[model samples]
Target: MLSTALAAPAAAAAPRYQRYVALGDSYAAVGTLTKVRSAPIGCARATDNYPSGVAARLAPATFVDISCGGAETPDLTTPQEVPLGVNPAQFSALTPDTDLVTVSIGGNDVGFGEIVRKCAELSFGDPFGAPCRAHYTAGGTDVLAARIAELAPKITAVVDGITARSPNATVVVVGYLRILPPRWGCWPLVPFAIGDVAYFDGVQRSLNATIGGRAEAAGARFVNPGLTTGHDVCQLPGKKWVEGLVPTSLSMPVHPNARGQAHVAGLVAAALSQ
Candidate 1:
């Protein structure tokens, strides 16, 4: 009886999952040059993306990462057009047997890239003031925040879809890392206007909060990209997890570098183990 009872507990303590699938946008794809070129060319799956790190650490029997650049929530269910190919629906990877799913999406859905472009363009004319914030909040309403609210439901739907398709899966939603300092950081280095730095920083935090809440509400766990506060683009090459406009490291402008990917990988793995 003792041996039989011990077996039950021991089996239960084994790895919680054998099959794992990762879904997300560019932020989740952050890392160095390609080591695993399994994803499409434009999908930009780095050799050291957090998903790969998680998979390696967990040693799952099977793992799939379909994260792509420029992907939105809708792309989770539909194909996304890349430069020379099409990334199949991320949901296609999920099956009844899938027991772990991680997602880090929603920035593009909220028009973040456009906002950054517009903000950068506006900064040239008013480098000393909050031109980007003024432009976004021009009509007495914050359009960026409004967009986040409108797209919030789609994120919830993504979690729901994952649950319905992979009922046994542990869905974990990962939030974006902080790209800027809390206050007005080194402006020209990052290209954000002096006064608009804090404003845009707040916007990022708000987006993370919205996604984290929606994911939790939709029955998935949340993992904030914590411990990245001081590692934003403004920092030097060796210290920064994200690179600035003129990258001093091997990462796209304003994207996470190798160190960032590795750090967040540890964070995700820790979250899963807990």
Candidate 2:
């Protein structure tokens, strides 16, 4: 009886993760400020991305990261072409033995890069008003909101696909960090007009909520970095996790910097511990 009880606690406490596979897009793979790693050159997969941090911290027996720049949900099932190389269908890394999976995607599906660029361009036209918001909300439609609603099911499909492929894995969906604050502040640095700042912020919040909802509904866990605000683009280099239109950090404009990746990894690690 003593042996059985002691072994039960030890077995229950044993590490469940061994083979770790990471899937997602730029946010998941590209720590724009960090040096490129073993992934394809075009992937721009950074050595310091959240997955790298997590792997280093957890010291998994095996690790595979197939994340890439500008990836979408379809990219998870189908190969994606990057600037100078092609990232294989992300799901190819999974197996029945895989025990850890992280997903950080869906921004590209909504044309997030283009939206930020457009909002910046529109801000130049009317930096005092909400020209960007007006442009997107034209014809009595909130275009960004519609895109998110349309994308909810597709995001859920990704969860289903991941679970089907890696049945034993503990899936963690890391939500995007904040970009702009809930109110307007930065002007020339980011170029978003006074009203457009909050407008885009709302769009991002909705997207994060969808990602979390899908992950939880599909029996996966979600970690929301957005909950800790003040790391948005408007903040200075040290304070901001995300860069602005003209990046102050080595990261790409509007993407997460090295600090941001570290923060995300910490959040994911905490979630895993729990």
Deviation (Å) of 84 in candidate 2: 1.7
Model 2: per-residue lDDT, tens digit, 1-274?
Answer: 4687766655434355789999998898878645986547788789888999898888888989999988989999999988767899999999999999999988998889999889889888899899988998999999989999888888788888988988888999888999888987689888889988888888989999998998899888999988778999889779999888778888888888889999999999999999
TM-score (all chains, Cα) for each model: 0.92, 0.93
Off by over 4 Å in 2: 1-16, 32-34
Off by over 4 Å in 1: 1-15, 34-39
lDDT of 1 by residue, 1-274 (tens): 5687766654435555789999999888757754535458788888688898888899788889889878999899999998778999999999999999999999999987888789889888998999999998987999988998987898899999999999999999998888889887786767789888899888998898999899999999998883358999888879988878788876777788888888888898898778
lDDT of 1 at 238: 92
Worst 10 residues of 2 by lDDT: 7-16
Q: Give the alpha-carbon lDDT of every model.
A: 0.86, 0.88
Question: How well does candidate 1 score on lDDT at residue 25?
Answer: 91
